[model samples]
Target chain A: MVNEVIDINEAVRAYIAQIEGLRAEIGRLDATIATLRQSLATLKSLKTLGEGKTVLVPVGSIAQVEMKVEKMDKVVVSVGQNISAELEYEEALKYIEDEIKKLLTFRLVLEQAIAELYAKIEDLIAEAQQTSEEEKAEEEENEEKAE
Target chain B: MELPPQIQAQLMQLQQLQQQLQMILMQKQSVETELKECKKALEELEKSSSDEVYKLVGGLFVKRKKEDVKKELEEKVETLELRVKTLEKQEEKLQSRLKELQEKIQKMIPTAQ
Candidate 1:
């Protein structure tokens, strides 16, 4: 009985530990969400890309569409802002998703273990009952032998 | 065993988050590339013309004397000045580009910073 109690305790401890890990993952995901929001704010500054007017390309004119690269710097800045903002959200979401996947996998294993544990408990109880019965039989045999 | 509906819902949510994050990352990468290109272009421009201002002031490095060295120099200076004007115009364009870039970045500053 003492050994059985110890087995249950160990299993319970393992389950609790797994739960703790999952909680930590949730916390991490929350932080990531905040970061994403901050990054989004920065992304707002980068809306100036591809806003240049396109010069008409004439078939016979030697004028190749000069990419009025004059505004390239502004475009770069706009895009960079977006990058910072967008990346934060991206990273946060990825992390959250990854944790969820791990959670799912871990939960599946834990559920299986819990089910198996119940079966083991039933088997243990049966064996315990049989042991008691065998002790009684031994006592009777001894008493008869003495008689 | 079948999983709980809540867990399934959570999984679906995670999928959405993953997709959103992927899209965000793509935007980030493209923006980063643009910044990098701009920096590269600026660096090249600086490298190609360190003495841009000096070049704009067309003059003889060595002093020479003639019947009218001053007038000749003045004529030469005027022609050189015209060329310098073109360079100045190009420089103006560069300055404008930088300004526009700054504006773009400024708008994004709220989210990026």
Candidate 2:
């Protein structure tokens, strides 16, 4: 009867490690979200050089921004609520921040739950192990009595 | 003539528990794979769309023909952008599915001692 298919100890230990890794991932996501939010706040803080709206800016709201960043060469930064959703970069950064925040929050709750599950699984495994050991002891005692 | 029947029942229960765990695990794996694929597709779509935008509206060339090229690029970028938007929506849907599958796995966890 003691086939030992689900070695609860090992399984529960694996589960604990899994939950810990998940927690770390969530923390990483939280950091990323914070960083993106900072970038957006920086974008919002950018000084507008002011240009007439002749589609003067692609997406038109960015006006103009000058820099030597080289990475963002030929690019402009726009402000205003409506402008946030139009440009791909602007929209992507903004939404990715939001997604990471959500993912972090969800992961936090899930890890807590998974941790509880692992604790329970550990308990079950221990109980099963003990029960098997006791059964063997009983069988030995009975043999001694029979002899 | 035999040992207790409870042992048999316990054995059966444990087996059932093991099967249940396996089923849940399989579901988790499937959902994880789907999520990974969805994200990969979305990333590729986003990259291609960004490249399109850059090609079309990339410069501030003063020549009239250059301006026309820019205008055409912008229009193409706009249409490609809608595809990206659709992909975003699909991504969000998959994200929600991921959450549901995770919760289902949580629920499938067997009882502790």
Task: Report per-candidate DockQ.
Answer: 0.01, 0.05
Native-to-model Cα distance after best TM-score fit, residue B71 in candidate 1, in Å? 62
Candidate that scores best on lDDT: 2
lDDT of 2 by residue, A9-119 (tens): 567677777878877777786786677676666544431322321222234566564343223212322221111112354554555565667777787787778778777
Segments in model 1 whose C-alpha atoms lie over 4 Å from true places? A1-95, B1-113
The runs of at least 3 residues in candidate 2 whose Cα sits more than 4 Å from the true structure, single-residue gaps closed, are A1-6, A44-97, A125-147, B1-52, B55-113
Give the number of the best model, judged by TM-score.
2
TM-score of chain B of each: 0.41, 0.42
True contacts kept of 2: 0.00
Candidate models: Cα lDDT each:
0.46, 0.51
